[model samples]
Target: MMFRRTAFTVGLLALASSMYSHAEKVEWSQGSGQSDGIVVSDGANNNARTAYLSISSAISVPAIKKTQEEVSTLKRELAEVQRNAEEMKRQLSTQQNQAASGLKDSSANLSKEIDDLKRENQSLKSALDDVKRQQSQTASSGSSNSSNVSREMDGLKRSVEELSRENDKLSSSNDRLSQRLNDMDRSLSSLESKVK
Candidate 1:
């Protein structure tokens, strides 16, 4: 009889240990209310025992509330960060579009100016060629005619020299503009990389 009692006590202790371990995994009830009961039976004597386990002490209301508040605060912070990122994206897009538009306008204006200069240069060359032909034809006619032709040729030469200087200046301006455009492009690329 003593041996049977000892074996029953060991089985009860093992069952209680298993129940305790499982109860630890259970979600804490919001309210500290009642102690849960479990019944155990010893097969030999056909007797039953009741075990009561209290889980209310393990539930911490203040800790749970603090954790919830922290989560809410983190969520708000994350939302604010997202909003800021979107605003930055929008601003960057606007800046890039404005820069591109300005670049296109400047390039178009430069192209038109270069075209106009080329046309003017061609016209001046044609005029100078005509003057040369007339001078050659009248060379043997007289000294007065030759002198007039010489003066006209000198004027044409001076005009040609001025056009050459103007063309050189325009070329230099075009090179500088191209360099500025390259610099702007690199700056935009750097900005984009930093954003990414």
Candidate 2:
């Protein structure tokens, strides 16, 4: 009889230990309360009800505190993300403004360059026209047949041809520069669109 009582006591101890281990987990009670409560029970006769109430009280407050702490941490993370996004937007706006200002400055400079080239081209044309008029007047005065005058006339013709070639070269250069300006204008427009 004593051995049987000892075995029974050991089995009860094992069952009680297993119950406590399982009940160590906190469960949230579905109710409108400040702290979510827990309910624990030992699978036994009379003492089970008493054990459940005691464990429930012990576990409820800590579980609710943990949930609140997690919520606070999530709120902080969300605020940080919003701040970072605002900073990125400000930086992008600054960069776009700088790019637009630079493009405008470049366009102004190109206009000035084109105006200068046009003035130089007109000056060259005026000089060439004056030289041709002087040659025509010399040709009309056919009084002397000296070798020196022939050589001088030949030299003047050569000068005229040289000037003509130089003018052609300048005109070609101006055309190329105009084409380059057009290309730059297109590039600026494309960049502006991408920034927008």
Choose the strongest candidate by TM-score: 2
TM-score of 1: 0.53
Model 1 residue 166 CA deviation in Å: 6.3
| TM-scores of all candidate predictions against the true structure | 0.53, 0.63
Candidate 2: residue pairs that collide = none
Clashes of 1: 0
Please identify model 1 stretches exceeding 4 Å from their true place: 1-57, 142-196
lDDT of candidate 1 at residue 30, scale 0 to 100: 29
Q: After superposition, how far is residue 86 of candidate 2 from its true place, in Å?
A: 2.0
Instruction: List residue ranges in candidate 2 displaced over 4 A.
Output: 1-60
lDDT of 1 by residue, 78-185 (tens): 999999999998998878667666756665665666566567656656665675666565564566766676887677667656756765665676566666656656
Error of 1 at 140 (Å): 3.8
| Best lDDT among the predictions, by candidate number | 2
lDDT values, one for every candidate: 0.62, 0.70
